[model samples]
Target: MSDFDIKSFLTTLTQRAGVYRMYAADDELLYVGKAKNLKNRVSSYFRARGLNAKTVALVSHIHHIEVTVTASEAEALLLEQTLIKQHRPQYNILLKDDKSYPYLHLSDHNYPLLAYRRGKKRKSGRYFGPYPNATAVRESLNYLQRLFLLRNCEDSYFNHRSRPCLQYEIKRCSAPCVGHISQQGYDDSVRQATLFLQGKAAELLRELQQTMMAASEALEFERAAALRDQIELLRQIQEKQFVDSGQGEADVWAMTDWQNVLCIHRLVFRQGRLLASKNYYPRNPAGDDDTELLAGFIAQFYLADHAQEGVPKEVVAELPAETMEPITEALRLSIGRRVSHSRGQRGQNRKWLVMAQENARTGAQAQVSGRQESARKLEEVKQLLHLSDAPARIECFDISHAQGEATYASCVVYGAEGLMKDRYRRFSIRDVAAGDDYAALEQATRRHLTRLKEQDDLPGLLLIDGGKGQVARVAEVLEELAISTVALFGISKGETRKSGWEFLWEAGAATPIMPEAHNEGFRLLQWVRDEAHRFAITGHRKARAKSRSQSDLESLEGVGPKRRKELLLYFGSLRNMRGAPKEELEKVPGISKKLAEQIFIQLHGE
Candidate 1:
């Protein structure tokens, strides 16, 4: 633990009311909190009397503390939520969820129909369930269309129907837009569909069964069979329900708080089937109680889901009754549901809440472990490279060519966890001779150093794939660019062209420093050196292939683009074109006798 000034840091806080954040030396966010009296709450950290274990530990890492004065406690809470999502402070309760939830998109055409989609609202269609998974939502949609006999065809197809399509003949669609069914009958089907999505499955099923029995007594066999099918479809839909609370389409979300972290898991039910589940971990969560944190996550989580019409009919949480009403109304308006929150602790309803909580715990633990592992690997790399600080950013350069022909260079980057491919670059040699290794190296070094000078962010290390020569060239380039601070090294293969045995080049040294056998430094240099070589060789191969293709064409005389392209397409390459006899040359579409002779002479040198 470093010496942190607790009293000095706490003096700025006010009991009046505000939000505050604590940060570590590396700028990692430690925690975010809001209090009625900002000064009083913040002062607790500096107490001569013992503080809670969590507070004591957090205070030890406090190099800097920042604050924002809010007008009221509610304002502070809102700002705190925004910061938690943004910073993901380590010591705060985090809600980890990133998957896009499914939504039922209701098209805004004259006939307004239902469809399933996910993501930000792009078109003017009402979207629903970012269902638990695509499978459940898809099956529900199929059954709904079957039971309601609503048309599934697009508006374009609906408009062009002079006669009924197969959907009508098969009894799956009423075809209202094409006049196959009366407006009143179509409206009834639409109403039934809307009710099913609203979670009134029992009512819809009961009505369909009654209709079927009534039709049978009248001896209308054809109509009776159709009604029976609709009833069966409704029953099938009901069978897929994992937990039916006698309520309709809705989402049940639960959260678990542990080790100052929060995990929020949600299950989406649409058309009586559990459609999908999503888990979110928001960093730096805080509340007066567990219920408050859950309430905060729901509000922030659903606001994004609402615009897409994915809001549920009911939301069940372990939170107290006081917080449920506003959350329910907010969600209800988003997806047009009469949203309700349940607090039943002793039934099948209670089991759903527990299951959701379990999922949250498992998800949060896994995410935290992954983050720790990444951090450890980064630490390992830093120690091995003898870096003054952690190498959060690395730059590797390599040269590629075939005996110096088509020589090109590639620069690649890696940081904290792995490679940053977006920052990778490839350069064509501009001032280097073919087959001249030193000259090609010089050209690449100069261009890369010049660009690095103009860029704001610079790499922590400059890795070259050759021995002392390569390292010295890069150092010279850096010096010329007026940049003298970069840590430069060149890695060259040993006598047998095998790895593990390498030469390390540094500035002002006549010889490279070769590490002892099985040393950590050797392993570190090998990793970076191999990475640079791979990048350079890949670039060189591509350049060489392109040059070989165009050069063959360049050597041919009296052949323009049109004729040369004809020759290439006809014979494939110069070797094939030269092998072709007089008759084969005559068969080419654009080839004249003189032009063919010229090509033959260029190829055969006859």
Candidate 2:
């Protein structure tokens, strides 16, 4: 147990609140901990006798220790969770949160954009739900499209529309791009949609009634009919809303542990209605008691801000008696607000806890079975693809371009957990033919394959975006690199250019090999391919935007990044820049009359 030096590391431990990590002799992480006093808490392991069996066992393997100081205990709790997630320390209870729920985001604009998001909420907009399933979010979005007719296209797509697209033709959108809907009309629809999301059906219905009556009174029978239809839809939706009494917002948490497996179910309520439930499997959460686990999870969960829409005002949980008050106080300090952490041991709260517990038990068993199934499928992939071993790391590549402009390539990695985002990379095509997809892929492979020259880090499977031709190029690149063990393949869009129907190819193979459509191997390949396309498209869009903006601004003398930004901010857009009067340009604070004239002449191409 004394395999490495732990005594010297303990000498440097600070007295301030922070998190500490202990590593075993093999550099394997043993545990992660947060303490109000690092020196006191950490030293207790080596200095204090009569330690708990778990701490005693963990300290014996602790060949190394690392500490990170924080401003407060609350910050330390967050940092501890983050480190646990990254390292998956054997002696720590880590939350195994794989999926993030989707939210329906309504953009703040003259004509709002409706879309689905599952990442960090960085944009300022109206967001609803951490919906349990993506299908639910999509369903809600579809219903909103039918009732409100808000635009659901990207800003770039919206900006380029010369006329209404299929969404407008099908009556799902008001065609704001073509001026088919007035600003006031679109604004009203956005307001109504917001009210619907907020679960204010009664108020929204009353407002709709007034609007409908006024439309009828003004002899606008068509508009009145439309309003009447919307009202009927709202009533139907109101009937489906959940019945709950938590004063609009509350989060319910309950847990179940079978043997050494632990699962926690979190049911979130917004506007007095159930929005979604999330299940977590904290990594190796076997050693701790229920109270310690609950306290640690509460400190990490609420403070993490992992879910959208911010923290709820109330958290109802089936907590061990000893941990309730301290957990509540910790949450208060973390959020700087009086957040209620109620023990769901009685009344409606108890019922909520019961439901969550039942779900937790079921979910934990299901999660275990799912991991087993995924492992089996990976083995199947190895045999099916004729690989040397089960592929643990699969890398997929794709190239995106608009005709012959703004070429970009993306490399997305798929590991056992699916979509290893941290390993994904994007490459900009320089001095290459944008239309030549094969050459673009070759460049991407050469760049990526060169970096993974080490024996272990190179992917077991190499997936290219296109068929036959792309496969040949990848094979050529792999040959040039003098690497041969990696299994290279390409996925081609079939005759219909659809998902499910895509063709697969092995390196240098002219004929396509077909895996059954329902096979897990096929589905996994499709998932990686689709994700690669998505990544490539996003990078391509950004590259094109940057190139256009830079070329336009850099064409002018003395107009660098800062001045270009200032002019763009003042005028709002390139269109506005072209239209501004010379006098107005001169009044832009930094622009002299001579410079303004030059700007006008350059913009107008005089």
Highest TM-score against the true fold, candidate = 2
TM-score against truth, every candidate: 0.33, 0.37
lDDT of 2 by residue, 146-240 (tens): 89999999888999989899998888999999999899989988988888888886688778777877998999999888887776555434442
Q: Identify the leading candidate in terms of lDDT.
A: 2
lDDT of 1 by residue, 1-606 (tens): 454544433422334445677778886779988776776888777778788888789888887665544334533454565567656888888866456776776666656666666677776855655554444466678777778887777777778888888877877777776787777777677778877877787678667766766887999888877776665556545542233233456567877753334677776555544334456666642335667777887888777654243666667787787888887777677667576778747444555565566556654433432334334545655666566776556677777888878787888775543445567888888766777777777787777777777885677777777777767767777887778667777778888887667777777688767776455445545665576677777667556657778575664657788887666545445655554444346546788766766765555433
Q: Local error of candidate 1 at 266, Å?
A: 28
**Whole-model Cα lDDT per candidate?**
0.65, 0.72
Question: Candidate 1 has what TM-score?
Answer: 0.33
After TM-score superposition, the amount by which residue 441's alpha carbon in candidate 1 deviates from its true location, in angstroms, is 2.1
Worst 10 residues of 1 by lDDT: 365-374
